[model samples]
Target: MPHPNFILLYVDNPQQSAKFYAPLLDKQPMESSPGFVMFALDSGMMLGLWSKHTVEPAAPKIPLGGSGELAFAVADAAAVKALYAEWQQRGLQILQQPVSMDFGFTFTAVDPDGHRLRVFAPYDPAL
Candidate 1:
């Protein structure tokens, strides 16, 4: 089976979404157009922003978030807290504050298009 290396998020405007993500991801789009934008992550994965109105197969009209989340794993709880503060300072809509969960120390924020962005430090029994 082929490994998955890409993720696409439907957005109202790919250009606008790119603007919102560029600073947060600290990367520029390797590919960009009116209806699509693509960013290359350090992990070799790719993130794509596709215009909801222009997707070929027609995406469902349901709400944008809550269906899933794009999660970023950090080294420790302190890192999660730092990122949470940074994102908050950048004006992201914070949905959850830093808290310990069964999985880790985490927080949730939303993009302008309502895509959930989760930052977490995986629970480490060794720590």
Candidate 2:
């Protein structure tokens, strides 16, 4: 049976959002246009960033402050930490610092267009 394969995100500025997420995402978008961009994830899922103004007026809006945070599972905690530091240096707001949690180590940051993203690495199984 065919299953869900992609997640579409509406942003005020698709180009800026694409630039901001390129480094954080596993891979840059395979396709990008003036109003949209698509990134292929390692999990076989795809993410689409589309300009809000370009979407049809009939399209449903994603509720503000909804439970739609995007979380990425990384392979290395150090890499995630470095990325968080880099983003902070680039003037992005850091919502949470890298911290050890029950499930793993994670940090949260807001993208250029205000989307919340969490980057994390699983704890060492040998710990």
Candidate 3:
């Protein structure tokens, strides 16, 4: 099976979500339309935002949050803390503060459409 290289998030408004994510991800939408927007990430992964109402087959009626999270992995605990501070200044709705869990140092924030965004540093037993 092929590895998934694209991730799509169902959003209330693609334009609004694109605006919110563009600067944060430091990438402009490679494609945009009334109901859809797409960004190409540095890792060759594609992130797409599609209007919830317009998605074919229809999306299930799930709340905007607590379904799943898009996680970004960073280098270390300090990087996690640094980003937490920066995101705080930018007013991302923080759901979890920086803390060390069994997996690593991590935190969770939410986008305007209530999609969970997580930043973490993988656990390194050494250092």
Candidate 4:
């Protein structure tokens, strides 16, 4: 069976998106070109930046990946708060401040292209 792995985020400018994510992700792009950029995440996942206008064959006219959220889970609520503060200081647009929720504590931010990035830490200490 095929498994999911890569995440391709359609961006207006691959180079600019790569630059924006580099510091936040704390890794440089493993591959970059006028139309595309790729990064290797610590979890062995691949994140690709593809030009919004250039996906071949069945490419949508509008940029993709803006509607879905990219989530990061942490050890606990404190970690969630820490990341929220850090990202806020880093100037990512904050969509939601850290708050208690059924799942635990979570905060959301938006990337340059308006894609949601969410960080959460479960209330259950065992997790």
Local accuracy of candidate 2 as per-residue lDDT tens digits, 1-127 = 9899988888888888888878767477899999999998888989999888888763566565345778878888888888788778878788899999888999987776667888899888898
Clashing pairs in 2: none
Q: For all the candidates, what are their Cα RMSDs to the real structure?
A: 1.1, 2.7, 1.2, 2.1
Positional deviation of 95 in candidate 4, in angstroms?
0.4
Identify the leading candidate in terms of TM-score.
Answer: 1
- The full ranking of all candidates by TM-score, starting with the best, is 1, 3, 4, 2
lDDT of 3 by residue, 1-127 (tens): 9999999999999999999999899889999999999999999999999999899989999976738999999999999999999999999999999998999999999999899999999997785
Give TM per candidate. 0.96, 0.77, 0.95, 0.90
User: Total backbone clashes of model 1?
Assistant: 0
Candidate 4: lDDT of 102? Answer: 89
By TM-score, the better pick of 1 and 4 is 1
The number of clashing residue pairs in each candidate reads: 0, 0, 0, 0
Candidate 4: C-alpha lDDT: 0.86
In angstroms, the error of model 2 at 111 is 0.9
Angstrom error of the Cα, residue 13, model 1: value is: 0.5
Name the top lDDT candidate.
3
**TM-score of candidate 1 versus the correct structure, residues matched by position:** 0.96
Angstrom error of the Cα, residue 2, model 2: value is 2.2
**Tens-digit lDDT track of model 4 for 1-127:** 9887899888889999888899989999999899999999999999998887787764655544446888888998888988888898888989898899888889989888878898998777675
